[model samples]
Target: MTRGVRGATTVENNEAGEIIEHTRTLVLEMAEKNNIKPEDVSHAFISVTKDVDAAFPAKALREINGWKYVPVMCMQEIAVPGSLPKCIRIMMVVNTDKQQTEVEHTFQREAVKLRPDLLEDVQKDQQK
Candidate 1:
């Protein structure tokens, strides 16, 4: 089965390098915990808010993971009223046998501030 997991993170600044590095670390950690190999990644999509326009977050992941064939994309998040700022979100689809309920999602830093519910779920998972 294939499962989709969502991750959200925040950038301290709009620097491409920093955003890329932060995203790279977050994605890699998610992949690591789920035992998802690079080859198992079907695709990765990154959405950044209007405040971020430095380098594409995907570039950082490609460089950090050294994935030459994995498809990646970066898009602008819809500007909704009262939306969070400096937020970068990632949704990754992985081919795995794990059930959706068993899968782990991550939200960190100020991003956690945006999704305390999701963060609580992750924390609860860690305890189990």
Candidate 2:
């Protein structure tokens, strides 16, 4: 079955380095928590808030080892009023044998506030 593993993280600035580094961290954690290998990934859809135009989040995904050929896309996230800024979000879809509830989704930095429920799941999983 194919599952979508979600992740989001925030950067302190709009600089390319900051964006890329934070995005890399979020992607890596999402992959690790879900046990997703590059070969298992079908594609990744990444979006950055309007304030983060300094870099393409997809660049970070491609930079990962063995991920060069994986399909990916980048776009600007809808600018909702009062929404979080400097946020990069990713939906990594991959084929896996694990049940849907077994999949792990990660939210890092300030993005953790975006989904406290999922963060709670992560915390519970960490105790296991």
Candidate 3:
């Protein structure tokens, strides 16, 4: 089976370093918590809000030790009114035996408010 792990995190600023660091951290945590190896991932989609134009968050994925060959793409998110700003979102499709409900979706920083129902999932990952 294939599972999709979703995550979103916010950057304090639109600086390249901040975007890179937060993007790396969020994706790493998402992969770790779900035990999704780079080879297991079919592909990933990353999107940042329009306000974030500092850098491509996909750079962080390519930097991961084993993700060099993994397919990744980045683009700007839909600019919905009142939507979260300075946010980056990642969706990864990984080959896993885990059921969809068992997959963990992570929300970090202010992005936590975007998915309060998944707060417990985020808390579990944080405890590790």
Top candidate when judged by lDDT against the true structure: 3
lDDT of 1 by residue, 89-116 (tens): 9888889999887787877778877768
Instruction: Pull out the clashing pairs in model 2.
Output: none
Top candidate, metric TM-score: 2
Candidate 2 local lDDT, 1-128, one digit each (tens): 99989899999989998888998888888888888889999999999899999888888878988889999999989999999988999998899998887888888899989989877876898899
Model with the higher lDDT, candidate 2 or 3: 3
lDDT against the true structure, each candidate = 0.84, 0.89, 0.90
Q: Show the colliding residue pairs in model 3.
A: none
Per-candidate TM-scores read 0.91, 0.95, 0.92
Q: Can you tell me which runs of candidate 1 are displaced by over 4 Å?
A: none
Please write out the lDDT profile of model 3 over residues 53-120, one tens digit for every residue.
Answer: 99999999888899989899998999999999999999998999987767888889999989887877
How many clashes in each candidate?
0, 0, 0
